[model samples]
Target: MPRDRRPVWAELLGTLDEKFVANAVVFEHATPCAGLLLRGEPLRTETGALDRELVLRALAHGLARAPELRRRLRPAPFGLTTPAWVPDDDIDLEAHVRFHVGVVATDGPELPVLLAGRLNPPLDPRRPLWNTVVAELDDGRVAIAWRIQHAVGDGLYGMRLLDALTEADDAGAAGDAGVAGGAGAAGDAAADGPGSRAAAPSTSGASTSGASTSGASTTGTSATGTSATGTSRSTPTVPPLEPGPHRPPRSGAELLRVAWLAWWRRQEGPRGAWHEYWRKPFLRRLRRWGGRLVRPVRNHVLVVRGLTESLVPQRRYAFATHDLPPVARRARELGGSVHDLTVALALVALDQVLPDPAGPRLGVPISRRAARGDRRNHVRMTVVGIPPGTTLAEAVPLVHAAVATAVEAIEPSPSRVAEPGEPSRPAATILTTAGLAHASPAPTIPALGPTKSATNSPTLSPGHSAPGSPAPGQPGSASPTRDAPPHPAAPHPAAPHPAPDAPTRRRGYASFVPWRPRARSLGPALVGSAVLWPVLDPRDDLAVFGSSYADTFSLAVVGSRHVDVDAVQRAFAELVLGTADDVVAAVALPAPPGAGPGVRHDPGDQPGRRPDRQPHHQGGGTP
Candidate 1:
């Protein structure tokens, strides 16, 4: 019996978030996109508009379009939806977008407030996968935020939906619309702070379909030409992309097409694509599992974001390129490896922030083989150990300690006896995330990557307080390098007394793997952690509250609910940069690893790197 209506699950799947699933989807290149909201109108009046009608009407208009907010979803085999992403019960326009106008008992200018609260609530299997939030910023702007699990569809697929709903008339204007929803502008109510992509130049096209940002973690680097022993490895051939009926290729389709052609590619070597596809057949027995919930249209919320999302404008963000050539040159000067410097930097960052910081006071992801037999692009996670905080004087030795711990963590190979013939992920990953190392330590980070440890990850995002995401060097996340730990220029030169953990140690950022390949071709996405606690330390008072964002640099501020962003940024500079006034580092790392001795970090880089004859990542794992 063919049914005309979609099953309940199918409709629910339509509301699934694309960003969530793309987290797990590995990429050879291409960064993911994230949603950014813009305020259509600013509430300049202080007392707020007393007329409930217009405010309510606008709210109603936004909510009415909830179920209509749609995205094509990809279901897993056996009628199972990807574990990531969920839909909410229904949309509440007032809740999602608010007019802060409270009943002042006096009618002044119409100052309707936008609700900053959103629906990123945790969901269970019994319900759909999604959330809606009506976030009211301190300013009159409002933003609806959501975080979908990363187990659904690719970002491009999400864009297809936007194409369907968006207007082609002005499809290429990267300019802001006008006052509110206009291009490149976000008012206080617009949340995501200022200068967000939401505030970027407006999308050239009308992004009618809800926008999705994926591949939100990690930075882009030259992966093609690396100097391996002073000789470059030939760049491998990338497969071409085949255009689908639903979504056509952009004129710059060369790259994405390359990625696609690589996928489902024919097996040329000894191993062939399995003789047959494995299909789970539970539906034959109870076929109506999801079908029983079939309905004409499933009720869900629609999400939309501006192309030029703002960054809350506190501080510029960072990619691994931060130090670039300068740092690389400096590392060589110190007679150490580049990755060694990275380990040192991670430690320095931790030491600067953690209160009463003691022992390594850090976490890292170990790459282990996958549990499943598949070995395409996958990795399991494991935790690495860190000693307590060391004085800035003792930086090098401590960095070395952190490196040794990382080296030790990647040692054990996968156990074959009990787990034989199962799946095979990455070796460094499994051992780290299984919680074995986390539970065994004096001072250690919790498991995070793939499974999320504390708030932090390998690729760190700006967190006013506890900042951790699937960033590199986060616990159980991804470790960007495999190398010996090189010591920093220890101010003390001698080892410091062994220290113990402090109350703040309990609040350390959890670990995660932040290795992600971002393609400038696709723009940026969300991928980090943050935690804001109620308790303010005495240090918080001495702490400064100024600007962390300089002329060109910026970082992301995410996850934390209670972080006083300005204060946090100030603390970062005072503690990390040595002084709040020093917007740029007094001593900057070399720009682009291996650049000329005097070259500063090049802000305006071309689309690709120079076609050097060397290959930098011969044995290097995916970033």
Candidate 2:
């Protein structure tokens, strides 16, 4: 076989990182044939500042690097030096260019992180990176969705791509981390790729008309610790905090306390299991419960191969993007952009549920895509705290500053990622490395879409036997609609507001095993975590990025019937709506969120996500 002589970009795409755990699952169940091929979606912005033409040019550049793209698409693995997947570049274009872009319903259950835990997606080892659907909602919002092989990028990489293309002026380090930090001269030796904040051609240059560019938004730069994993939480109906303009700069000690407090609050309760530093026995119980109840929920047939029918089940998901322009505007009265103020509102929402303020730690991804080859799939997952002591008067900045610290801590390339670990088997891994993929069809708005059953016939099945007719994507199974492309242009709006200009929220949801097994039905937390990943190939880490006031905002999710969905949708929306002002302030003035050098300082630990099942790419957790 003649070795691929293509440029790094060209050869890169030739061999998808089959070693990733997520890749194996996708390969095993891919429609028996390859589906679509697209990179991630374009960054969403209310300002419509993205340089579409430049984006096209970037795509063209990617096409020119066909060999690399082909290499990226292959269902095989490399000898694991980061799987030999990343390509060198000067801009954060690789992540965007590697796959195609598409959208899903704005109103649906939040997407989960497939192959995140400790297993990898299964792959057929015969195709290319499957697909990425950039979903556009009628409510003026957008979602970048995909299912590339797990071997490609880690959670950090996924987060990096999402963070890079986001509107830096506002999304600054994806909420807290989105603060504009420093600048770097493009193509300069000291700032070439990975670690530098090199300048990209703006969406306004002569050759540019629509595509937008970015400057690193991490304000609170630090050699801080990176943590994107956290406990699952529900939407709380908190009353808005009294508006105010207050606070003086905190001493270093005070700053750390506030940041940790915020982080601890989210991680303290039952929802805080996600933050458990060491896997506890309770974690085992949760998995056992999931396996007993959720995994074998529906059995198709052994005709599918390796697993049984119940593993991957067909399901529906719904979420809401409640509109809050009124509340958002009102929030500005306190501080920050609509984004920052939104976080203040979310703090109110979450507070409504539990009063005790043992704030929890949460993970936020930092995009290293801006650094050339780093973009191939270089996601830098970072964690930040909501500060247990965060108060309304101090929240906007409190969270802003804390997240800022997290964003700055994520370097383009981990300082010393141990020689990439040996690839693991698929299936058995946990959620750590897994990414959740979803499909939001026709209705487009947060209303009812088509309800067709997914199928995985014996011919398509590798060997496992499923019960009834094999449906597309059963739990522990896979269902891919590669042939169907999301509406090329946002679909006809289901609501009177037909235009995709308004950030619409998707409202579809599906249920998974419950966090609390005793409940008759599962809630959004588990459903959002489990259901969303099976539909699309396991490569994408599509989370919910929505507004709080959108019509469907986590409202109606109370009764048993709606529990599985309504809640998760709202939580995803809250995540989107939450924002911080001090985060921006910190970035503008160079205040890293917390303490430390930001690198994976746990010298004895491995910083990458571990997926279960499959190879190099995988998800984690006992299940």
Candidate 3:
């Protein structure tokens, strides 16, 4: 039915998290925008001014096919209902597609800063929740960067939108065909295709121009000799926008249905009341395997631990390389995928800087591709404890096993209905006596404090902590310096202590965190073997996000102005790449065809012919 009610999922997410943090600092500017970097020829007029007409035409054409792009969110009166998607009666393309005059160094270290600066700002709520920044790089290549709100779509949908925009000729053609149908279709076509004429800037009584610039906009008409009023002699023939009727409000029943559906999709539940009763039994088994699920913190790295409620504006640092072939080859040899290898590499790198190796509870984002709803955050998490100073060979297996177990556990199981006599829901606990009903709450159990790992103990030296043991002075520690001063370079603590009476120890599994707390701590950081994959046009690809995070890691690293970008990159490369090499070396190769007495030389081996076997993939198959 095209979901006429409203974006229930988006409303839920928006309300759940009002803030996002990273690297122990709150990310004040986390507005959840899916960004893209596209490389293509600069679309400029011969006059050297931005070809507003052509650009608008092509963009409009693309938007025509994607109705979601044309829709603007209208929140219900006083937040009484979910935000509904309505057609933007006033569509302004120029305001959305802006031209940047600065020289963009696409491959340099400055690229991350450029992207963060552009994305940190929130998308205009009144308009279509998207913007495109077209900047000309120093090398004369054009970089088209897009920032679309996550509330509107997800990674896959964002990719589809970009795919539509890039196919200029096809988009324009489709847009032209749509225009002839009706005013509504015409508006969609005008949003993306070059075949349609562009609406002049509302403020100016100027005519659109057919002439394209040789380069992007740096100087206005003052440099290009074009009229400031935009009155050009060659305006292309295209249909003008005809105002459409105001969209009718959704029915009360429809609105109620949406609200009900959102409630049904919630993670914690009435059925989950069983967890409250079954928690003790589950904990007993978890304790036997692994102790309390304490999240591992990177104590070695520097951090600015701001107050949990305070707003801490944070920035991101991104560096990518075109060299992944060697690492990929090595991963296959170690009986692991590239993802497994990446996790091992990250742990190895972190261990180098950490005083002790028993990693904090590291959360790996696992993608829930099979999720039913079309919500953006369709992902689960897997927490893995990286052992201290573990070799790449050993770590890969550990990573693989941990991820497999987490993914399997998170999978949705068939719902079990309670018997007629049993209380399946909390509401069912009511008992009627003497015409009065009394609610009987479930029996509350005494919560246990955090359990100290049995193997957790002290170490003789900072780097010499024994595997599976806790750091000095930590619970269950036997070190003499348990009361020694904290290390001067120790990383900032992540958060405040949990409530005194709360269960200090709990089993680790795929569990949902409260929206506010999770949002407050979510920010950008190097996580889960983050790999940089270059696109067909490396110059155009603004960012390359590793899909592994959707399914394995959400490592938010907080970086500051004082952070050394080059130095950090070098250390990271040394750890991840070095680990890859270690894995490849550890793999044993088949002893070279058993050097036998009967030496048989074929014609191919004798002269210019090819050898029987050339150096191909190692580890027996392609990574």
- Tell me how many clashing residue pairs each candidate has: 177, 231, 43
Which portions of model 1 miss their true places by more than 4 Å?
1-126, 134-144, 149-360, 365-456, 459-507, 510-568, 575-623
Model 3 lDDT per residue over 366-482, tens place: 434343333333333344545455566666555554554444444523463444764221210111112100111000010011111111000111122223322321111111121
The 10 consecutive residues of candidate 1 with the worst lDDT sum are 613-622
How do the residues 1-623 of candidate 1 rate in per-residue lDDT, one tens digit apiece? 75323222222232122212221111111111222222212312234322233223322322222222322232333433322122233322222222222221001111010111111222222332232333232222222333222222222122222222111112112211321131112111111112232112111111101001121211111244221111122222212111111221222232233333443364443344343112345553244335323311121111122111121111111111121223334444443343333334444444444433343333332322222221111222222223444333244334434433443454432442433653232211111244222211111112111221211122222121122222232222122221113333432243333334323222222221121111001001111111111111111211110000101111221112222232333333343333444322222112455666533222122123211100111000111
RMSD of 3: 22.1
Ranking by TM-score: 3, 1, 2
Candidate 2 stretches greater than 4 Å from native: 1-19, 22-69, 73-125, 132-147, 150-331, 338-357, 368-373, 387-394, 407-565, 568-623
TM-score of each: 0.34, 0.31, 0.47
The weakest ten consecutive residues by lDDT in model 3 span 514-523
Please give the lDDT score for candidate 3.
0.32
Per-candidate RMSD, Å: 19.9, 26.7, 22.1
